[model samples]
Target chain A: MSAYEKYLRNNRLPHILCSGCGHGIIMGAITRAIEKADLDQDRTVVVSGIGCSSRLPGYMDFDTLHTTHGRALGFATGVKFAKPELNVIVIMGDGDALAIGGNHFIHACRRNINITTIILNNNVYGMTSGQFSPMTPQGHFATTAPYGNVDRNFDICELSRAAGATYVARGSAYHAVMLTDLITKAIFNPGFSVVEAISQCPTYYGRKNKQGTAVDMLNAQKENCVTVAASAKITSDQMQGKIIIGELHKSEAPEYTAVYRNIVDSLQAKEMK
Target chain B: MSPTIKLLQGNEACVEGALAAGIQFYGGYPITPSTEIAELLAEKMPRVGSAFIQMEDEIAAMAAVIGASLTGAKSMTATSGPGFSLKQENLGYAIYTEIPCVIVNVMRGGPSTGLPTSPSQSDVMQARWGTHGDHPVIALCPSSVEETFWLTIRAFNLAEKYRTAVILLLDEVVGHMRERIEIPDHVDNVLTRKKPSVGREGYRPYQPDADLIPPMASFGEGYRYHVTGLTHDETGFPTNDTEKAGILIDRLHKKIDNNLDDIVEIETQMMEDAEIMVVAYGSTARSASRAVKDARALGIKAGLFRPITIWPFPANELKQYLPQLKQVIVAEMNLGQLILEVERNVAGKAPVHGVLRGDGELITPTQILARIKEVQ
Candidate 1:
């Protein structure tokens, strides 16, 4: 068994994710990241909104909150603010983060609160049995978009960076080791950090679009993905069909809870005087 | 000794009540009438060494309170009609997960933001059945500034005790109206949630006690349990088993229903030998009270039955007055919401009449008195 196995709730295993689903691999990456970050398991909380990816927290050993659809960031903000010492990690799917939760996602990034958010962007709502999502590729087939998706997709890392997240990165489940490293850095970041894990929903997204079997979906991720450094040297046309992975952006900003603590300290000091 | 008396609006009193109840966290957005609760708490919470946050929206506010509550803090949020509508989804989440928190909805006129500053008891039905699915709710409506303060505290107590979201239902009339109240320095009867009695290894987070309420353990306490909105067994993990789901839903309702004696609160004035009984709540209850007094002096036996706990509807208690009354008149600021409950409780035992006013105005004492006279 892997060292991160202890972090998982073994009894809750035989998880509901479909066979060969990337969500399980992403969950493994999260546990390894938490372990590598040296976070206090007792003081750590995993919060998630509704989705197949959101179910990741339910099988974790940490105190987990499987909240309403598309509101995990808002809940994480409260948990972090309530106990600033606790490690707050939020998990969501593309739809959970970008569709109904779009406003909260942007606001959470803007606040720069101390939280590590991992969005498993599979481009479809798998738990709803294959609805096209905000992150779904244009012209991709989904149950809801039988004639192919007409809506534009969100570039999650770019959105997070623009919304003021101190650290923003994108990685695919096909490269689990690299994704784990990004997640570890995000957990260590002092302000809001986001990791968009481009996962494959072979059961729903792959089947709907006739994107071949589970292995084919995995192979597609590998073939399309390009390292950030490799992407920089490529022309726009060369990078058109490529998925850029690895650290997209990082910056230094005062974390929200830390700033709030300063205000609290100053107010307390004034009261004493 | 006389209590220190100060004049305060109903909203201001809610702040004091929450503070006195040791509420350590408040997450709310600025919505009309209810905004004062957040504003006052913002200035006051930090002074008391508690935390107050202005969330992005009402949905976040409710979500935040639930999150804070799981960490063992007495958490609360305040919002109005449109905001309350936004909070329903999360409120249902809190219900299914059985996380204790308080939500204050200072209702304004609304189908959709019809009147922002005006008063309406239009949300009375929404408070009872706003969130989808079969779940229990405890909503307390205050008729005055003093009642607002005490009921706010009671709301928190009920939330903590039941491990469920409790709604402190207020209206613009009660929330903004200033009245003299003797602010008690301390309340001796304030209750906090009962913590876990067993150690981490021995604890089952959702397993209920004899009273159907589980002793809650805070997040950092080492009992790492999965809390979810999905139907789950005692283990707190999502279960697809129909048998386990049935038991979970049944227990959720039974917890509150079985404990209705401690939850439901109703006050009756001059109910004996009365031919006409006025059923009212919140701000409109004040009018009913005045009208009852005037009718008594005019030699008509009129009485008032005010339900402070509006969700359970006080149906059992309302039945007691069926024998002494020829008429049951429900006077509210909305177009006959609470009257439906009264009609159900009365069950054709008496002639049930509704005196409703939906013009974003209080149901006047004159209207109630006229109804009482006509019924008599």
Candidate 2:
């Protein structure tokens, strides 16, 4: 059997990242999901912004677009609408997805175009020397937030669900098997789907906060995450400190492009009759 | 030369022109005074294997047109007033990224949602600078339906040639009127995209070479490339280097500026020894044409200088005629926007007379005739 990992740019392997970089893990899941779903590799387009995670496009064999900062999802929306035959994937860092491009993020979900957005939440910015991100939890110190973060973190699955995304799921790189399944399901979904992967950023986030090592960070994610059903049974007081990981939402209204096509067809048919 | 006859309203000829231009992809949400262009394109584009989509809103319509053009299709979207305002962000995007697409604004009167079904040539300046930032633009305005056909063809041609967003400024009177238009049979002579010689291997999308226009390889073409709105070098990497950023911006200006003479196309009617020249564009200029003839009959040395291409402003050519003239009457459906450009170009060489209108209607021939007589 041919190894599905053949689609990766193996020459760029043993990534240039330091230990516990979340990008490597998130990218592994996305490319593997594309392969597992048997998507047309040529017909896949990956767009990314100007974060460490954005480099995921350059490492893939697909028709990748490395766009400006915060605009990866915008370009991905265009790519998907342009050719509905193509499986469009947008990989974004937390800052690229929720901070600089927060407006576009919600709107793309609101429009519900057929795009699979994989948001890599590492809590701190890695490329710009570890700045704090919107997803950085309280008391997480970074270059920008030296005195510990006081800002509330964004739950990406909740944001995606609220913004009308048809499919919303969360997984951690620590749960490698589950990540593959979540990403695979997202890729096969017909409408807008968001897979938020809580991966490790030991070099910046962990080192600054003294979270031992990459392995420790991974263990933290595995230990902190509880089932959504289990969390629902618990009170808000119990859910305050723990993270919930599972599919949060899935339903269908018409995707934007298909609805557009239908409008044109119906207009023409009415004119003919 | 084939016989040129005037028998079409400004909008009908625009339809014929868009059809002649091989615009196979049209996605628009209809707003008035430009709805006929969308209606006509919807009806006619499909007859020729084109796809017409009435999108969810003007934003998606504008966005989809750019997407379609990137996929190697000549595409356009049309709107007026409120819809035009909604289109500027994506329009700004097109200007910044140098995407080749056409936008037709059959202008109507308003600052905000004023008169939807009425005619007004108010969007002339918006066509030039509607989108934000310091970017080059090519906005073509046609006075008649025939010029609409010709200019729409040129809008497509210039868009393909220069890689910029070209606007077709129309007014209500021109769009809904029917007339005879001889559509062009073939437009293969118009430039298609320049394919990357680097092929699919190691292709950088925004890396324009010496000519400053990079070849585009489509998405499914196996050529992985990047297009962004950031300041970047030839490798398409986002850069913070000041000198490199300046060069990239300068190249954007140079691509349009260095080729302005080919870009600025105008038609002068009897400017050899005319004492008064009435300069106008869009349907407002059609009124000026009759007024000039009426003034000539009144024994005034009045002539018409109408720009088929409103942008690249035809500044130098208009300046050439400005010095010898006593009065240059500028008339439009808007209060005063293009008049500013005219006055700047004239630069105290002559008094630039302004005849303004903003009542959701075309400036009547009589309105322009009074201006010609008053200016003379």
Candidate 3:
């Protein structure tokens, strides 16, 4: 009944996301962002790898591809390179993007292809039932890490920026409107763009970490995150343990498809001459 | 137009054949014997306005080919032993999803990175059962540069026709060997994936026709359908229903099995009234071809049954010659791979022998001739 509802496959409704899961909220943000960006529903593709968050594309009303685990970027890169005219949006989970798929993730950023990648960082592998992931906070409890996780978590926004993403941003599921704006901007970018959407896994991640209910987790995001603009004014001591939310990086670069196209055009021009 | 004739390596001929077959996209990694496929496509794809991408790894390369194929592009990728092993993951995905793409595995000696520059047909078994699961496969083996050219085109055609991944298995000797080949002015009967005639409304992405092949709609075609690796239904959405999964898996096998007559191709040399038959494929077949002629010249009735389509196994065709065969010799670079398949099909009708070498050397015609003489 809502305007963005048209972007969903109503027939596939009653999504498999657990009660109070933040993936639904993030999914709404994605649909809203696609609508806001005015992407032709027919010309846009939603690709995902295997995971709980990766299942989101199956419910979208667009050309959707649910590929192998950790290979969404690889598949999306092919789609973008094959048909640069089509808008390619890739959805992935923290484990799907950073753990098994880490090589593809970095290479996709390095290629600077025109793809919008939204990584739903829920801190643990919810689909596989709370296994420790690369995004799991250090010393956190997971099913696999019974005593406590010793692995250091990646700063996703920093990693994306370092990997040559032309546009990098981070938003929480609590900030649904801000997440939509960030995703929309990522869609508009002419090169590779990454938006890390911190989502809550109430059933697995929250319960395993003793983080109370999903509502409590959302409230924690509200209290722990500082806007990049606001963080600039805050002292290092004041910003401790606070995640930064907002656009973290932006720059111009020659997109992979455009560079390839130039090579093709010049070769054809030589043939003409 | 006159056909251009030039000496070309088997890998180079594969590139020419792919271009002639209307390949619009290529995603590959650099690997021995197969690297030339990526190298030449890089130079030619730009000129032809098609897409060429060197992926980070073989897995990504295979994934990209499937993605590009979903856009209705005739896409392909090439790799060798280790790379082919890495590609198995995505190859299985493509098989389950029914994406039309060509995977060229120019095999080298390997259990694990054994020999990078050496020829080995060790991957023949891997080509059939590498990906895991009871899935259908269509694989072609070429014995020379000329056969490589035509088989590469045929691989793409079969991929499109069945809406499944086709493997072009070439060994290092055949892939690297150079020979003069005629470049035809035009390639006839290049098949593309069938597009749905029905409109976007009431469209089921996996609804098969009478031939059991579902017409594909490219990503941007407004059909807005879903594709997944999980066992899916006619609507293309993942289904957990046991019956639906059975139907899906069964149909995938039947589509290729029922069309085996149209798919399987076997080349026979002096098979008529021959009491001894040599079963070979890929570069090994070249040696077997020469050995058969040598046997005939020595007043012995020896023949060769070279399976061009190695995967659907060509059992029916091989069975036809079983009534007269006293013994069967399978010669290959591997110690023993396809020989198992030969024994299975021959089913004790004839004594089967293997002239196999795994030490990075081709099985010589003399070796095959000796085996034929001993069996005779």
Of the candidates shown, which would achieve the greatest lDDT relative to the real structure? Answer: 3
Compare candidates 1 and 2 on DockQ and give the better one.
Answer: 1
CAPRI docking class of candidate 2: acceptable
User: Mind giving the per-residue lDDT tens digits that candidate 2 earns over B135-209?
Assistant: 888888776666788888889888877777888877777776666765545545665667788765567677786
lDDT of each: 0.91, 0.79, 0.94
Candidate 3 — which residues are off by over 4 angstroms?
none
Clashing pairs in 3: none
Candidate numbers, best TM-score first, in rank order: 3, 1, 2
Interface RMSD, Å, model 1 = 0.9
lDDT of 3 by residue, B30-80 (tens): 988799999999999999899999999999999999999999899999999
TM-score-best of 1 and 2: 1
DockQ of all predictions against the true structure, Cα-based: 0.77, 0.27, 0.91
TM-score of chain B of 3: 0.99
Over 4 Å off, model 1: none
Best-to-worst order by DockQ is: 3, 1, 2
- For candidate 1, write residues A1-273 as lDDT tens digits: 888888998988889899989999999999999989988889999999999999999889999999989999888888888888889999999999999999999999999999999999999999999999998889999999999999999899989999999999999889999999999999999999999998888899999989888789989999999999999898999998998999999999998878777878888889999
Q: Candidate 2: lDDT of A121?
A: 90
Error of 2 at B243 (Å): 3.1
